[model samples]
Target: MIPPRFAVTEDQIAAVVAEFYTCVRQHPGLGPVFAAHVQDWPAHEAKITRFWKNAILFDRGYDGNPLAVHRAAGDVRIPMFDVWLGLFDSVLRRELPSETAAAWSALVHRIGRGLVFGLGQAEGAPPSLR
Candidate 1:
């Protein structure tokens, strides 16, 4: 089973988030879009930290709506979503144990899918793709 807080320590979460962003920034297909959207990298990092903390561990510290945030980002293409998930999965795999990574992967996959699907719907596409 997954711990509500994901890792045992906040430092572990910080490490995972840092590594994930580092991977995304280096990925050829994803880096440009991320750079464009995340102009304020420090603020973006904090927002993502809160998002993951809330989603994976039920922490109430994060009040941002991730779906709405991505929806407002007009540059979020489908391939960008794919690359984001790929980087997240890859980085988490490198940072966490098998079981922890598995749990985190599942949640990240769902979040990524929802973000993409929300974009599709906003663009008048079918919801079935979700």
Candidate 2:
């Protein structure tokens, strides 16, 4: 059987990121955390855009180590992952078609799990195993 395909354009992804960050900046729980880490919004948004472009479109524009970056940020907590994912899901659902949102949410969920594990935030496993 052929795999399902979702057509996600770069413009749509950019709009999602932009709208998501706007929500993040206003969120009471997440806003302060992101504000502490992100000094310049435009630069951070550009970097994130490159990251999504690379991950979703195979654009090869992003090269930074996200795990290392998150680790260096020094403020990400385990429960924050849930908040981030929830916000991301809401924005994606609002901005994209259902199939496209599902596809992107799945990918982001995997990435969030890995990040949570990598940052030593997961409950059961040591960082080495993760």
Candidate 3:
């Protein structure tokens, strides 16, 4: 596995996930959308923490498909991703060191874009073509 891009611990990642979801739950635009899908906040936070760990630390602890999940939600609009990223950026900047925040922000934005593209083309073509 690749080394981490910056010096960040699992605890830091989990802390960010927890705080970010707290913001998401309180956000007017994001709250309703997420509330529909998330019933157990702590469990969701734990899952997302694993997702970030697997992404940044290559921990291989996360096993969920974000594209399919968002697509299945049917209400996950592309525009909403922009808002989500913005909120996430805010959280990162507030919670991490500048360099770490920038690195993580870049990663998440890339992930967000991929999810948007995947969601957009999901109905247009088969997985083989996409």
Candidate that scores best on TM-score = 3
TM-score of each: 0.84, 0.88, 0.93
Off by over 4 Å in 2: 1-5, 121-130
Model 3, 1-130: lDDT tens digits are 5998678899999989998999999999999999999999988999999999999998998999988889999888999999999999999999999999999999999999899888878475865453
Q: Give candidate 1 regions above 4 Å deviation.
A: 1-8, 123-130
Look at candidate 3 and give me any clashing residue pairs: none
**Model 3 clashing-pair count:** 0
Residue pairs in candidate 2 whose N, alpha carbon or C atoms collide under 3 angstroms? none
Tens digits of lDDT, candidate 2, 1-130: 3322357888998899899999999999999999998999998998999999888887777989998888877787878999999999999999999989999999999999989878875445555742
Write down the lDDT of every candidate, Cα atoms only.
Answer: 0.76, 0.88, 0.91
- TM-score winner between candidates 1 and 3: 3
Find the candidate with the highest lDDT and give its number. Answer: 3
Better of 1 and 2 by TM-score: 2
Which scores higher on lDDT, 1 or 3? Answer: 3
